[model samples]
Target: MRLEELISQFQKKDKKAFGKLYEMYAVNICGVINTIVRNEARAEEICHDVFIKVWDNADRYDPSKGRFFTWILNIARNAAIDELRSKSHKREKLNLSTDFFVGILERPEEDDKRDFDSTRLKKMLGKLKKKCIELIEMLYFRGYTQQDASEVLQIPVGTVKTRNRNCISQLRKNMSAS
Candidate 1:
């Protein structure tokens, strides 16, 4: 069957149609998810969740918005980003035993007393908002795809590119100023 016909059957909750769709797209979707999450096992779990999400929200898929592939590709990215956020939050909670602000502020000083470059990077990054820093970290330092960063930041992909361009511009300006 054609993709639209399969999707139509899927929307009507046809099990075999859904299976066929899964068979066709599951690998690609998992690959997209894996690009963000980086763990094959976790990517597999999140990929399964994305399909579940697709099944649950089948009625919401409007072809005028885009193709079925794009729709599910989006769903997969969203699930992967959510998984990243959840993992980050869990790590934060697990590491929350700092001695309030005093230790939080002093531990770095004690640990990196000789690292002037680290200090300079912190000073330079101080001008950027926490959001922009997170964006940079997610996109560059953490090896996220542009699509993954866009979904994680809840911004359009075009906006992510523009903001990244502007951020890089400012970073160069700051580095040159020092």
Candidate 2:
């Protein structure tokens, strides 16, 4: 069956269609989630949740706005990003306490290297314009959505998107030249 027909049936809550769609897209979707969340097991779990979300909200999709896969991809991306921003994930990542004999479980040299990398990152951002720094801090460091950044920056969403792309490009150039 063609993708459109499958999607239509999915929107109508057809189980077979949903199953076929999952078979078709699950691997790719899980891979993307893993890339963002960096945990294979968690990515699979989040992928399952994203599919459930997709199934539940199937009727909300508008083909005229974008492709069905893109809609699902956006949902997966947002879910992965949300997982990254979650407090539980933060706590999981913050398990850097000293071991009984190891002093810091993470080596002191690695810690110093991380501090140096942070200082270098700060220097790079300092070289960028104030607007670029603010945009990077919001979209990357603080995990603001593009729409949220747009509202906060008082710019259109498209403008925020454009600025983010341009700013990242400039940042890449700065890093490469150094």
Candidate 3:
């Protein structure tokens, strides 16, 4: 069946449609979560939670606003970001002090080699303008709000917003080129 029909059925609470959607997007969604969280198991858990959230809010999804995958991706991204911001997640990282210290001592020069995507992301950021790179780092990587970024960058919030949109667009272009 077509995606539209499948999504329609999903929104109507069809279990089979839900299972099909899960099978189709689980890996991609989990990968995106892992990109942000850097924890495969946690990413997988969050991916499952995101699907459940999607199922619960199925009726809210409007195709006219965006594609289904884009909607689901945004949800997954936000969920991963939330997980990063949670206190438990922070504590878990704090609990990794031994591993962190060991890693630093053992591979000080290969910090960028911790993950292939980290290196690739660094390369992608290198392709962007200095300002865009800074904005992307602050807004996305550091989880700064627009107002927070504006305050830190000493710019108006509106400018921060516009720059963020432009930077993401540029990044998308660079990613496609690569």
Candidate 4:
């Protein structure tokens, strides 16, 4: 049977159609969840939960918005994010959206518990000027693409690469001087 036929049957709550869809896409969905959650068991659980949610919200899905697989991909990604957020809420109370960079830069207290290399990393980071440090931090530490850094810093994207090269050169010069 065609994918559209399977999806049509699934939306109508046909158990066999859902089963066939699960057999076809379970691994892919789990893989997507695993990339975000970094745990196989958790990924599998999320995969199952996501399908349940998909079934529950079947009426809301519109083919005009996206393909069936794309819709499922979004659902899987969102479920993985929710799982991570729930786990984070249980462990500690911190707003990751706002504090991601600040948390990386500061310890906040002596007793604060985190497995991050802040002290030695801070010293190494001290070698660069503020802009160079920010750029390097965004690119390497925070995983910002050149285009992202450019937009955030209000500089041309082309300048990001040039400045990054110069920043590394400065870092090398500072290291040799020390």
Candidate 5:
């Protein structure tokens, strides 16, 4: 069934449709949270919270505003970012190294066991250049704007958009392949 159909069913409080939607997006949502929190357990907790938020705010979602993935991506990112800003997260003094999400991708053993369809993502991400990874991390994961990414990466502002487009294209290819 189409995502819109599933969403309609979900709006009607259909448990089966909700479960299917959850199954489809849960891992990706968790991945987004993990990219921000950099802790598997905390990311999982945040993922649950994001789902709850989505359920509570289901009436607010409008298809004309954006893609369903984009909507949920924003929710997950906002939730994860909020978690980072919380008092406990601040007090913990977590070291957000330069690599951030890249560090997670590079951890062969742990990334293998934790992330869903790890091998596929590893292979897809492996095809991307280091700069592509960095740009995607900054722009998508870290919520940096084009200007911020360009300044941080020392690239021209014009390059940031194209670079991000290319990076997402690679991700799309990987998603299709998997």
Candidate 6:
């Protein structure tokens, strides 16, 4: 069944539908959170909270508003952004630089973790150019707009879209190969 069908059933309190939705989106949701939070455990916690928010706000969803994935992405991003703005995060920021998601790839312990399967992710990323990775990390993972990424990366604005599209295509190919 389609995601919209499942969502409709879920709105009626169908457990099976809800379970299917969870299973389908859990990894994606976690990945989105991890991109923002940069901590696996905290990302997992936020992932759960995001789903709960989605469930509780089911009635508020409007098909005309946007794609379901886009909606959930907004919720997950907002939650992760909120966490970053919290008091505890403020304390942690005093000691560490506010690096983006690509920095996580360089963490030795995180790279070795089986739960995150960082090795596989690294291999997939290996297929992409360094510039592609940077562009993707800035635009998608760190939530930078095209204008923002262009300014930060010192590239043309049009380059941001083309570069991001190419990067995502490379990622899709890598995923298919894996």
* lDDT (C-alpha, whole model) for all candidates: 0.73, 0.74, 0.74, 0.73, 0.79, 0.78
Q: Please write out the lDDT profile of model 2 over residues 61-109, one tens digit for every residue.
A: 9989998877888898788878776746575653211121122222454
Our tally of clashes for model 5 stands at 0
* Weakest 10 consecutive residues of candidate 6 by summed lDDT: 93-102
How would you encode candidate 1's per-residue C-alpha lDDT over 83-109 as one tens digit per residue?
777775665532211122222233566
Clash pairs detected, candidate 3: none
- Better structure of 3 and 6 per TM-score: 6
Summarize candidate 3's per-residue lDDT along 1-178 as a digit string, tens digits: 9999999999999999989988998887887677567788888899889999999999999999999987888898789878777846665542211122122233444665665435455445546666776676555434467887887779999999898899899889878877
For every model shown, what is its TM-score relative to the native structure? 0.52, 0.52, 0.60, 0.52, 0.79, 0.79
Where does candidate 2 clash, by residue pair? none
In model 3, the Cα lDDT at residue 48 comes to 86
* Per-residue lDDT of candidate 5, residues 1-178 (tens digit): 9989999888777878888989999998898788788789999999999988888778788888988777888999888877778847666664333475466468767556754555665777877877888888777676777888888788899999988898889988877776
Stronger candidate by lDDT (3 vs 6): 6
> Which of 4 and 5 is ahead in TM-score?
5
Tell me the deviation in Å of residue 153 in model 3: 3.1
Which model, 1 or 3, shows the larger TM-score?
Answer: 3
Misplaced by over 4 Å in model 6 are: 89-101, 104-115
- What's the C-alpha lDDT at position 60 in model 2? 98
- lDDT (Cα) of model 2: 0.74
Give me the overall lDDT of model 1: 0.73
Best by lDDT: 5
Sorting all predicted structures by lDDT, with the top scorer first, yields 5, 6, 3, 2, 4, 1
Instruction: Give residue 111's error in model 4 in angstroms.
Output: 34
